[model samples]
Target: MLIPAHFEDLPFDPQRPRAPRRQLRLESEGSTASGETARVLIHNISTTGLLIESAVTLAQDERIELALPEVGNTAAHVVWMSESFYGCRFETPLPASALGTLELFSRVISKAAPSESADTLPVRIARLRKEQGLTLEALAALVNVSKPTVWAWEQGKTRPTPERIAALAKLLGVNEDELLSGRDGNALAQALNQARQVVAEAFGVDPARVKVSIEL
Candidate 1:
């Protein structure tokens, strides 16, 4: 051990179990131990562990589930926390080759899903617009509304009238109730559950394995 001063810069360690750890920055949806769902930004991840940054406060040893890229719904326990930053160790370690690679994930979702309903109008509209490859401005122009108005609809800020709802539903190829069903989280759990099935089909995965939270 005393004869290795010149090898200090070498990033490899023969004593370590595997290859060096790599880093990735990605976004995901996580459910807290308290059953609250929030958006989380994954700062870095490896087969054994990951670091997450979120607005939600987490406690030490709290159990949480993260919908990770490539990997599916992975259960982890919070090993450490400091305000909005937390560290975790996966309940079951992933394959060494599976970590730090969202570029591959991007390829997997390159083909958009077909028109389908979602848990809320905002989610439905957002999903439809993405499927049709339309941006906010484009959708707004086609709908004869301001960009903010379209955004408002996507955020559940305001629900359109029945006539407007009909037009939107027709435009998105979804039923009106899919858009109006949950004005604001009114029994959206059921709708989101159904939407997960559609998402699974769209991505050619099993419904139970769809961990990305079926977003808009």
Candidate 2:
């Protein structure tokens, strides 16, 4: 039987709590000692370590270098493994500045797990805009709309007309159907639910009584 483990359950000194991990989906590149590179998917990250999934064969205790966006190459060693997923501890914990950059990148690119939420229109718009390195103002200028209007569309406060959506799709390099479908709302909902559960467990309260809210 496969036993599930939480990061908090890992062996550690009781006085020093392990760093919290944030869920994210980021495509990154990793290379082994022999300099063979492979594409890897980052599932979650913390300053101290990361959980990654890759098809490249990796053994426990193997050292690898990961090319992190904005963070440059980081060295890590495999601490544990289950199938294609590997838990790696960084040789040096990420500095605060690098952690900030990684967090920003995560917020920009992290997608909801397919089982948790289908990619929504708002999610797609926000993701594509960030991926293209276009600010709201820049995208608005290209779409001939006010910056707030673009923000409203991304926040699901308002939606563009079919004509505007078609224009947006073209600008975003996707088709109309791809732009209009999939919702980001469910991703937020899932995160909120997870938060509530965690808080409830910490306080020994019912999840229903734990209200969670996120600003932006």
Candidate 3:
């Protein structure tokens, strides 16, 4: 469970210290663009703008819709984009009901530091490997890949192929889509891949497997 990170403390005065922006892992389920649902994580949020770290890539000015649990789907526009992180400004402010729910969730998160046990790519891969009782060597053999390849995935040094992810899903008893696309899919994944290429140089691994959202 990857918990979203939020700021601590709400100020009594309206101008007092507002809650720090929260980092949210959000899923955009259905929209006109993506026939299927999409998952995304919002790294930071403020009244004016939102910084999202998505597994997919989005074009500038792309129309995006987000589904907040209590808020339902809301519309936004992509104002900024890097390789992995994109910024969106809400087209219309959310309803009071939805804002209330978000406030409540933020308060709860503010009281506690983010739990490390929450969602992480490495943890996901480790759990999958453990559940399948497939040693790194075993999985490597199954995939007709080198042991280092399997090791890379486990260590967050690489990511596996969608094909391999499909196979691994069956072995680990998890959804193929979840494995192939940890949170973001479609365009988001494309953007994430581009970001990984730059970051991979420091890590000496393929951006595909060791992708921050998707495990190698």
| Clashes found in each candidate (C-alpha, N, C closer than 3 A) | 0, 5, 18
10 residues in a row with least lDDT, candidate 1: 1-10
Question: Model 2: per-residue lDDT, tens digit, 26-110?
Answer: 3222223433344455656788988765666677786666565566767788898755667899999987676665655444333
Model 1's alpha-carbon lDDT is 0.59
Estimate every model's Cα lDDT from 0 to 1.
0.59, 0.65, 0.58
lDDT of 3 at 23: 23
Q: Which residue pairs does candidate 2 place in steric collision?
A: 119-182, 119-183, 120-182, 120-183, 121-182
Q: Is candidate 1 or candidate 3 better by lDDT?
A: 1
Candidate 3 local lDDT, 17-129, one digit each (tens): 44232223342221223232334545456545576655566678765555566756566778977555677898777665655455554454343443347555556767678
Model 3 residue 157 lDDT? Answer: 38
Model number with the top lDDT: 2
lDDT measured at residue 176 in model 3 versus the true structure, 0 to 100: 75
When 1 and 2 are scored with TM-score, the better candidate is 2
Worst 10 residues of 2 by lDDT: 1-10
